[model samples]
Target: MKNTEVLEERITAQGCTEHLSAVEDAIYVIGGKWKLKIIIVLQENGNIRFNELQRNIPGISARVLSNELKDLELNGFVKRVVHAEQTPVVVEYISTDYSRTLQPVIMALSNWGKTHKRNIREDAF
Candidate 1:
């Protein structure tokens, strides 16, 4: 092979490795079934209580929701606010500005999901 071709191949391989590493990091932070869903709900609702969040995403148990919230908070995608002045302490979860960066990704996934469902239905018939 030509020297130029070898150099191009090396660059391509390195690019692919970098891309894969970035994707892996993103997945590690937000790969779970409930994490994105939780973010979506929080973004839509602004600030919501724990019970409200659980209700918004059906099928998520309190334990799982709690765990996911903690993960999101740690990742800086979510803000947990506590209101102490109330007779009983009230806590709410809100999406951080940083989480807005995922809006495009979420939209892309939503569009792809719709298309996939339509294709599946057509194939079924």
Candidate 2:
């Protein structure tokens, strides 16, 4: 079955469509591979310049990083500050308080990932 149909069935089975929809909305905002990584880095580093952000996230193209940052900013998870007074303008990305709400979710995902990896290794043996 298609993913949506599967999700619908799961929602129906669990009788928690509202919760599922909220999760879908959360995923829509921060579901991508780069979005969460960028948020985590920004949260850790406080404020980072464009090039510095790109360097912190290896393997992300400049274009993709730009797009992701825009999305995160639009979603209120990140703030883009530009300083034009300097001879060379400086732009920085910082995580917003809204992004801190995802801390529990991130921790849960991290713990689950570790458990999943251990389970997979055990199964492989």
Candidate 3:
């Protein structure tokens, strides 16, 4: 059987379409490493400039960040603003109303990760 067919069968067995859709949406948006990090940064800082975000997030190239931001903007999770000014003009990015909806989800994931890490460290003993 195909991968999607397997997934559909498993989803049906779970008996929760709502749960599956939520999981699917979460995966769709946070599938990439850069996307999750970018959302977290924007959540913490409110609005940030392009270079500032680049500096804050290590291992992300300008082109990669640009592409990620563009994707986020297209998906209604991020908004980009260009400042038209003389001498060293800037562009800033901020989370949108839709993005704010994910705040609780992000916090929950962060908390779970922290707890999991702590448990793993303890288990190493």
Strongest candidate by TM-score: 1
Candidates' C-alpha lDDT: 0.93, 0.90, 0.86
Candidate numbers sorted by TM-score from highest down = 1, 2, 3
What tens-digit string does per-residue lDDT give for candidate 2 at 1-125? 12342443544545677788889998999997899999999999998998999999999999999999999999999999989998689888899999999999999999979978988898899
What alpha-carbon RMSD in Å does predicted model 2 have with respect to the real structure? 6.0
Tens digits of per-residue lDDT for model 3 on 3-29?
342453554545687888888987987
Better of 2 and 3 by lDDT: 2
Span of ten consecutive residues with least summed lDDT in model 1:
1-10
Stretches off by above 4 angstroms in model 1 are 1-11
Clashing pairs in 3: none
lDDT of 1: 0.93
Lowest-lDDT window of 10 residues in candidate 2?
1-10
RMSD of each: 6.3, 6.0, 7.0
Among the numbered candidates, top lDDT falls to 1
Residues 1-125 of candidate 1: C-alpha lDDT, one tens digit per residue: 12342443554788989989999999999998899999999999999999999999989999999999999999999999999999799999999999999999999999979978988898899
